[model samples]
Every structure is written in structure tokens, then in C-alpha cells.
Target: MSGHGVALRVVACGKTFADGTRALAPVTLDVGRGETAVLLGPSGCGKTTLLRIIAGLETPDPGGRVLFGDSDVTGVPIERRNVGMVFQSYALFPNMNVADNIGYGLKVRGVGEAERKARVAALVALTGIEGLERRRIDQLSGGQRQRVALARAVAVQPSVLLLDEPLTALDAALRERLRGELNRLLRTLGITTIYVTHDQAEAMALGDRIVVMREGAIAQIGTPRAVYFAPENRFVAEFVGAANLIEAACNGATLALPGGTLPVADGALHGPATAMIRPEAIKIVPAENASLIGLVDSVSFLGDRQRVLISAAATKVITADVPNAIALAAGDRVGLSVEPAAIRLLPGDTT
Candidate 1:
């Protein structure tokens, strides 16, 4: 709560190992004051490398500079950077109780007993770990342990908070619950947080902007709504969620699918193109009134909605989510309709 989250800048930053393997290509990005920016991608995508560079745990290649606001901190060490880091593992000290663990950073910095106790108490309350201050690390559950770890990290009020898959170790239900809690906490603390994860849901939930990476380079950077609704590339569309990719030729009016033609918007010139439709975008209507018809390969009831997998809607199979009370089933004939604006045309032909 007392932290000052500054703007972080990475200019021409890149990483390479001693063995001459380039871990990351040169890149530049900015994390604005009090903003949460997520580095999202698969393993070995250089997300962690960039995070370490920002945290001062890993040195960038020459000519790369990491700046905390106006001051260049490229030569600084991790301890001197004033950063709070939380990892997938709850890296709390086993011998220390919760109070001592939370106050360890203050102790290391030689803060007086009175000040350390006050700060620890504030953090303990902030992280909802008040009643467990006297408990040992072994006495807490996975969620509680993570809470303590986060509290310990924030107890020092670091300038930037770096979290690397902090909630991944917990079970599914706990992970989800903690994600919402963490999002609220980060916003409440007003900390400039940089979270790294391969989970799209986590990125969507927490990030003010997501930096999508691939093969040691950045693929795209945008807000959750921008990335989800208007993906820049085919990889982004497919990776973020289930996308119904329809490959067809455009004649400036409509796209010709195997089943039928769907209306198209402008800017999709005469050439080979791919259209991406999200599962929720495609509507299931009566066969005669629909734009295209397909046989329902499978229908799965998912409480509020039903997931219908189309065996053949076009050249590719399409997955659609419709209302649960549609009375649809596998082996049933169904019609699919989609809004023209919802159909996003991707450039080039990877068909």
C-alpha cells in the first residue's frame, strides 16, 4: 500500500547464454505506472528471460538497458533493484514463522523492531494472513502458503512486483479463486506488476495489456479485448482460444466456404484469405433460415451453454457454443449463422 510503482522501460533488451544460444531477440517495451503487463506465451518463448532482465536476475546483452523510471538500472543487482518477486513455488523459509517470514526483508535491511513489526502487521492484514502469523510454513495450506509468499514479497513495498506463475502450484479451484484475489490485491496496492504465465485465462484476468511471445520474439501486444476480439495474426487467434478458421477466397463481397458463402466486410481484397470466428460468435439457427448448414458431430452440455462440434461446416470443422436449451444433439442437422462483423479476415494464405 505504501509502494511507489514506477514506469519500467526495456530498451533494445535481449539475452544470450554463454554457449552462444540466443534466448531472446532484441525487444523494447514499457510498463506504465501502476499498470499490470503480462508476458504470455509457451515455454522457451523468452518470457521468463525478459522478466529476469527486468528483475536484474539476468543480465541482458550489450546495448540493452533496463530503466526504472528515468534511472537506468542495467548494472544493478537483484537485491539493489527493490523488486518483489513471487514464483510458482512458495519460497518461504521453513524455519521461520509467518510473521518472521513476512518481516525478513525489513530485517535484512536493518529496520528497527518497532517499524518491522508494524509493517509486518499491515502486510499480514492486507494479505488476509493475520490469524496465521504464529504458524510455521508446514502448518499452512497451499493457498495460505502462497498468500504468505505474496505478503512477504509486498511487505517491503518494492517498486515493481514480478510474479512467475505464482498460482500454478495450487489445485484448479484454488488457482481460479486466488487469481481473482490476486488481481484485486495488485490493483489495491497500485503496484506496477509484471506477471508471466502460459495460461491465457490468467493473462486475460490480470493483465492491463498482454505481450504474446513466440520462439524468442514477440508476436503481438494489446489489451485483452483487443487481442481476443481482433487478433493480429492466425497464431494469436488459435492460441488464445478455440477459433473456427475458415479458409476461402474473397471476391470483395462474400467468402466461399464449402458449405455456403458468408457475407464479408471491406478491406478483404481479392485473394486467398482466412476468416477466424470465435466459438461464441457463431449462432445456431434452423437449417432453412441459416447461412450455412452442418451436421452436429457432438453436443456437450456445459450448464449455461452447449458446445456443439460441427463435423463439417466448411473445409475445416467448426466448434460452436449455443444456449443450453436448444434441444440439440449429436447426429442432428443444424444451421450456423454468424455476424459479418464478427468474421475477421487474416492476411496471406496459410491454408
Candidate 2:
């Protein structure tokens, strides 16, 4: 679904806390109007800091700039920025009822009682919380409380929506369910959204484009399929999914693995390189065919499939995902084969 019609831009944005910790580097990015862009990375990777800067909760460094549409908002205050934010903790007023909490912003802006009630009622209906108007904050379920928070944020019709790990406080099942619902709701509203989350699955499922960060810098940005299946670097490959990087000698059109040689696709890197392969890409067969041969060291059931860990030559541990019905045990000899097209040769020092 498309994002909101307003573009949010961050140019050369950087942040350093008062305690001398540089939380963000000089990073630049753009979130298109009505596109849900997800900032994903490990902890302390500056994703949250960047979001806070855009929200005007924290100031950017000297060379940083924040803008909405064509207006430069680098010096704008939080209240005047017209941005909606959903926090990880549902920051509802414990003393207020659901309706009052949802209509708090309108009241602060001096909206008349009749107009406030109508707006809050419409938002409650839009968020599917029709009958819980009188419920207290403590009386609602976690998911319901989150919906209230979302309704309250969007009640003002802010220009941009910023979400900071909004579903992380819920249980796994609830988180998954809410993610699907939130995706649908956001798409229906067509609001420009910047979602910050460390959960790769959530980022992949909801984002139109996933921005992978590392050490306060953008590592890679692309569609979920592009980031997962065709990573540009070893870090992106390993971070986005489980990858097996095998040291190999590339000679124009062939790569030398530990046990066998495989033909490389056109434009494959030459000389010493790392061959990146996914666990599921390697198939366990009866005989080796331009791939390695190894003995099964461990086998574990992963619900829909059985993951077999094999010990190949050169002390390499390769994992192969087979069907659950495939009967396999430790000490079994198996040959591994990977399609040439699936073999990604990356140039780097893998040591």
C-alpha cells in the first residue's frame, strides 16, 4: 500500500548524546509519501535515535537536516511538527477513560466538546474499539490498549506517523496478529510511516522497503525479497538470514569449494572470494555433484522441516534443511549440492 502524501527527509542526520556517546552518524534517507519504510538493525544501531530526531524529541548534529514536504523542520519543536508517534509502552493517561485519552489532543487544541466527541467517536470506530469508550486504561487488554494508543495518535491527522517498536511489549502470538492488522490499517489510511523495529520478521512483513542498519550507518536498503535473497554484502546476507560463507577460489567462471568445483554464473567475482549460500539452498543427496560431501553431525526438527548439520572437510559445518519426512540420523553420509545461480560470490576477507 502507498504511504501518506507527505515526504519525510533526513539529510546528513547525526546525533550525539550529552554523555559523549555518538548515537548516530551522518546518515541520510528519504521516506516517500504513503510508503511504509522500516528501519531495522541490532540494538544501539541508531534507528531509534534517527526516529527521535525526525519526531523533534532529540536534536540532530550540526550538519543534520529534517524536512517534511518542502518545509525545513530542523528547528521545529515537537508540538508544532504535526507528527504522530506510537511508543512501545502504550502511554495512555491512567486517570483518563478511553474516550478522554483518545480525544486528549483535540482538547489541548481547544476543540469544542461536540467536535471532540464526534472526532473521538469516529477514531474509536475506525480503530474497531466501538464499545470500549468508557473503559479505563488498566481495564483493557494489551492489544486493545495498543489500538487506543494508535487511535489517539492518528486522531490529529498528523502529517507523518512514527512508530517505535510499538508491538514489542505484547506476546509473540499477539504481536503477530497485531502486525497483520496494523499493516492493513496503515495501508487503508495511506499515511507516510517510519517504523523502527529490531524484529526482522516484522520489518519484512510490513515494510515497503527495508533499511538495514549497522553501527549507526545504513548497510543496505531494498525490498524484503532483495535484501533476503540477493544481499549485496556478507554482513547483509548473514544479518538478514542464515548464510553459509565458504572460502573459495574463483577463476572467472568456476569456484573451488572444499570438496568440489562448481561452475559460476556470468559476472561472478574472480580470485579469492566468499561464496554465500543459504541453508535451504544446499540439498542433501546420495552422491556429490560439484558440491561438498559431509557426514551428518546433528539433526533437529524445526516444525515444518528437519535441519541437518553436517561436518564437511576443512572443519566446515554446513546446515541443510530437508523435509520432515526425510529420515536421517547422526553419522549418516550425505552429499550436498547447490544450484549455481544460488551461489553468491562476495569479495571480502572472510577471516
* Regions of candidate 1 where Cα sits further than 4 Å from its true position: 349-351
* Cα deviation of 267, candidate 1, in Å: 3.9
lDDT of 2 by residue, 1-351 (tens): 134458889999999889999999889998888888999999999999999999999999998999999999999999999888999998989999999999998888899999999999988988899999999999999999999999998887778999999999999999999999999989888888999999999999999999998888888899998998888888788888788887778897877766566667745466888877888887777854536667899999999998988886323787778888888899987777778788887758522
Q: Kindly report which residue pairs in candidate 1 clash with one another.
A: none
TM-score of each: 0.97, 0.93
Candidate 2 C-alpha error for residue 185, in Å: 1.0
Question: Poorest 10 consecutive residues of model 2 by lDDT?
Answer: 284-293
lDDT of 1 by residue, 1-351 (tens): 644888999999999999999999999999998999999999999999999999999999999999998999999999999999998897899999999999999999999999999999998888888799999999999999999999999888888999998988999999999999999999899889999999999999999999998878888899998899888888788878778877888888888877777887755478778888999998888888777889999888999999989966788788998988889878988788888889999865432
User: By TM-score, how accurate is candidate 1?
Assistant: 0.97
lDDT over C-alpha atoms for residue 75 of model 1: 100
